[model samples]
Target chain A: MKRVLKLAALGACCLALCACANRPPAHALDRTCEMGGRHGATGVLEYQCVDGDGVIRERPQPIHRVISGGRNG
Target chain B: MIHRCPWPGEDPLYIAYHDTEWGVPERDSEALFAKLILDGFQAGLSWITILRKRENFLEAFDGFKPETLARYSEADIERLLGNAGIIRSRAKIEAAIGNAKAWLAMREGGQDFSDFLWDFVDGEPVQNRFASMKDVPAETQASQAMSKALKKEGFKFCGPVIVYAFMQATGMVNDHLVTCFRHDEVKALSRSS
Candidate 1:
């Protein structure tokens, strides 16, 4: 019974590590995410997470904006 | 190969950033604050690490608005540390919040952040024509002056080196190499009002 519990705990730890390795900063995963493409509608630049979990995960790139005076936030 | 400063390597994102944005003069107050905070977080880490996490920083910091960030509580700092996207340094995060408060105070003190910063360079981008990346300085007298002024204003995380990089990134000074296409292009941009 103790052996069973230890193995279960080890398995849980592995799962946690794996999830962490695959989490966020989506470019690290290098998966094919649709949102990572260029679409400069909002001032924030969004980087899409290409994980198996298809969702609205994006990294915002808010560097450029063509305001009246010049480039803006 | 197309000539560039070569510091950005061949990453598509880097190339795009170099071609489109770097060294472009920016007069926006919030944008300046965001870049300064990002540079502070870059201490002891490669800039690529920060670049990759830029989006995360923006989202977590309420787009880094001074008023919003100045109000961040301890609970917010804890939550930020747990976030997987941004650089998880407690000191850097705290410095960011502190800087935000400083920024707000400056604004309240009848200071136009844009005008105050631009005055460092006398309201014109300093045109540097270096022949190599090695020639580009890590920090200049102007950066040190800026750093001292910012520190006096009660801002945090702004040292000479970080402020120098911020200057380059914001086009307060154009550090692009003379051989690079962007050198002339970005220089021309500085003259456009």
Candidate 2:
């Protein structure tokens, strides 16, 4: 019974983490930024995304350096 | 991939609006009028606040019919104050009525409001293909011109920033990113229309 209860708790922890991870990330909110219409300039205008609620999470950036195939050193 | 505007989960209403109409161009006179007033109310508040209260606005403003709204009396204002469907500010509420009167006056002068509005861009929707969010702007020359014209015509609550947002919402411009799926679709519709 003790072992079974421990496994159940571990499963619940993983489920909670997965649920939290599945929520929309901050960069996903940037997808709504568009540049056409009356404003003739380019750039992301400040828009209230998600009704001003919810936390914005930053994604981890890649650390590896990539070399361009067409560029010469 | 399904292109969605950032800020989904703010609320179901906001999510629906972002997915369906945030950057979509609008053209109908009534729809334009509704958006104009709504954007003005959004001056210092989150759009989600406006969206959540849209039903109240619609009910209070007589379904956003400019002609009908133009006839609103002081009693109407009193009635709206007690209703919780829209922003309860006296100034903003009164501005909607004042703007409706101005809109009707413009119509009486043989000017189609849509045409008058579209004239800023010479009847063609401006198309933008920005790759990153940093490439968009808050105001533009076109919005400035439209703002000037509307103010000259006695309309209030229409600043350049508001006009620019109006233009985007009403299809006067296409500000979708190249990678966004709706960008090409909206562009094609603009070309065909």
Cα lDDT listed for each candidate:
0.74, 0.67
Which segments of candidate 2 are over 4 A away from where they belong?
A: A1-73, B7-10
* lDDT, candidate 2, B59-169, per-residue tens: 778888998988989998888776766666666778888889888888899888888898898888899887765666577899999999988888877888878877876
- Encode model 1's per-residue lDDT on A1-73: one tens digit a residue: 9999999999999999887863565444554642232111111222444454454555333111110101211
CAPRI docking class of candidate 1: incorrect
lDDT of 1 by residue, B54-157 (tens): 89889999999999999999999999888878877777889999999989898999997888888999988999888866577767899899999999998877
Which regions of candidate 1 fall more than 4 Å away from where they truly are? A1-73
Report the CA-based lDDT of candidate 1 relative to the real structure.
0.74
Model 2, docking class: incorrect
Query: Interface Cα RMSD for candidate 1?
Result: 15.2
- Pick the TM-score winner: 1
lDDT of 2 by residue, A11-65 (tens): 9999999988745655555333112222211212223223123543322111001
